[model samples]
Target chain A: MSEPAGMIHWEAQDSIGILTLDAPRGNFLSDPEFIAPEQLKDLLDQDGAKALVICGAGKHFSGGARLDDLFKLAANPVHLAERMNKGKSLLDFIENLDIPVIAVINGICFGGGLEIALACHIRICSEKALFAFPECNHSLMPGMGGTIRLPGKISWASSLETILGGDMLNAQEALNMKIVDEVLPQEAGMEKALLLAKKMTKDRPRKVIRYILQALRNYKSMPLAEAMKEETRMFCELAYEEMERRKNENLL
Target chain B: MKTSFKTLSVTYDDGLVHLEINQPPSNRMNSLFFNELSSLVDELCKKDGISAIVISGKGRHFSSGADLDDLLQKAVHPEKELSSSGTFSFFERNHFSFLYFEELNIPVISAIRGVCLGSAMELALFSHFRFCSEDAVMGLPESTFNLIPGIGGTSHLIKLAGLAKGLELVLHGEMFSAADALQYGIVDKILPRKEVVPFALEFAKKISVNYYKEKKTLYLNSAA
Candidate 1:
């Protein structure tokens, strides 16, 4: 589909949805050019959409938030807060999607771009992919939940140093830190992601897939007692369904 | 020191808790085995005398994983056997046992030999350190049976290894050797089958010493 200049583009491929970040200015996320929370939610809500693969349009995943836009927003504290909240909401939506989301990273994936990747369920990056939280270098911090998510992926010490030191991490380092899932050659990155998406979504019922994802999230977010209670309920439900199917097949 | 358990043997010696999976040839974990493990873990947690724990298996394999025959029988009428609270749910009880093992203050190491598959490997994941025999085979094969690891295998594996490796292991259900497990950062050390337990015990002793030293230092600092 055709899009206006500097607008995010997305299209459906079978059961997979690909969301591309394309901006005229080096794919640097700015308030005016970035994909909105509503647009992302709408894309995910599409009929028969089982998975999504997010990637950058050009050489860089993103150089991160534009400094000029930051400066302008800095002048208006209220506007900056609003924009930050919106960005957080967008990332939150991506993270909580029922279907799996894969971030196919190539070239630069720093700051806000890296935040987007972090929000995805799985991340596959090119061997040459570069990651960093250079917000500290600009006397700012990641506003879209990077600080919260980074510690969960890597050691708190490493996260602290990476965010506070404003240093770039190579793809191998990212893999070691458990930040990115797999590191492939730049040419093979997107292909691997699609293969994974196809493998995860193929032949899996939507209800089963939704249950698996929801249970995992509940285990993470809810108290142990409540999560275990729900897990037991789901397990019994699935087991009952399986038993029913077996009995029906026996009759045939 | 509890010398006798139906499927397991426990011996407490000089602050080191030696627990062994004693079922023959292929130590198939069953509901009874799990029940014993949970009770043992609860007792182990309460004792201040314990410094470290080294868990291993007797005879050929560490474990063949869950006894599928037993599991199937129970799952068929889970309300009668596997029920917790209302009826039907394996998640209610043994989870706390695994969590307690993972959350232990002192070091816990698993000395793995031969096969450590399915829930057995998941148990090893709960340990702070895992030392396996060079010829040991390890994997999570739940997907082969059209099931997921009901316990914390998925979560713990993803936490220890990366998300990709976790997905690959769980989805493909491929068995990896000890060397591969080491390369993948699953197990810490690989030893000869005969030396696996000795190595684990030695490592445990070292960790126990270090733990006490750290505790002493903390105490001194707080007093000062």
Candidate 2:
């Protein structure tokens, strides 16, 4: 079954949730508030998706946010703030999700498109993929956590250059900068992403995946000592459950 | 200035300091190497007008990692080296010494060639930039011995390569080549074996002049 949520088309294949950017042309995000945060949360929750993969419907991942829509929204300050906040929160929600989220990027992932990809836990791109922060050329910057997330994935200097210089980086250059986790042959991004998602989550207990992802996330947000403590606690809890399961199996 | 050391040799060229792991073929780090490293860091801290530091092995291999025999000895009899550093264990002291390289204000570059495994790889990880030769082999390999990297290797690995890739590397404890290291973001650049040190030295000179003011990639993208 396919569920169309605003600009995004959501579908479930086994346990993986595929969210595709479906737009008129080049998958440009015309709506500043592309999808409501609650709408996305409900989609994932109702689908019972163990993992999520975000892609674009056509050849390109996205042409990023349409300039005309953004300029029109900017004419109304209060409306723009409200809409942008919703957009920001939507990406934030995806970043903080307990389950892994992968971005299967094929073509141009520019500006807002790159920001969305940056929010993912892993990024797999095809050789034909191209990335850039063209926002600088337009005398704008990424409004949706791009500045914050880009630096974490790559060097501060490279991120600065990428944003300010506004040059396109091919798949190999993106991989070199650790912008994407893996690069596949042209048109192979979606298949590789699905395979990777299944390999990471299939047959694996949901709780186990959640715990691991949480621990990894904590490593970034929490202090070293606190994160280690949480990891130890999770490990002990898993160990206890394993022991109980073994005992039941032996009895049977 | 003290230029000679048992396990390390320090040389000053212009404002740059080239630190070579002096011990022969494998340069396997032992107690002596750690001792010398601690003292060298102290000297480097005190030195004035030092611009950049480039670390490389004297011979073929960067290092085969820690001397297993020495590590086992220390593990078996921890009490023997208890008095070396107050309040901290030998491993802790060594860890802090490695940490010092990363905390330095000047750029620290590791010119790696041949085998760089276990603790040696950990040392390279502490550097700000790693320029590895095509023939270099690197890994954290401690898990193979039923142990984890004791000296900040896991944290650095995770920080540079992210948690998923880092976890795989440590869990498998397998040796990876320079190409793999570059892909993992562990190595900044890969060059021919002969050019590794010279390229690192030249790059260091260029960046050290305006390290703070300029973007690093500006210098990194420039040809040596």
TM-score of each: 0.82, 0.60
The CAPRI quality class of candidate 2 comes to incorrect
lDDT tens readout by residue for model 1, A110-202: 899999999898899999999999999989888789999999888999999999999999999998887887899987988898888877666
Cα lDDT, model 1, residue B98:
73
Clashing pairs in 1: none
lDDT values, one for every candidate: 0.77, 0.80
DockQ of 1: 0.21
Q: Any idea what lDDT model 2 has? A: 0.80
Give the DockQ of candidate 2.
Answer: 0.05
lDDT of 1 by residue, B1-224 (tens): 54357988887889998888878888888988888987887677667778888989988788988776565444544444443532254545666777777777787889999999988998898887788999999998765555656667666676666666766665556799999898878887788899999878877776676564225335323322
lDDT of 2 by residue, A172-199 (tens): 9999888988899988888887777776
Candidate 2 residue B176 Cα shift, in angstroms, is 8.2
Could you report the DockQ of all the candidates, in the order they appear?
A: 0.21, 0.05
**Residue A182 in model 1: lDDT:** 86
Best by DockQ: 1
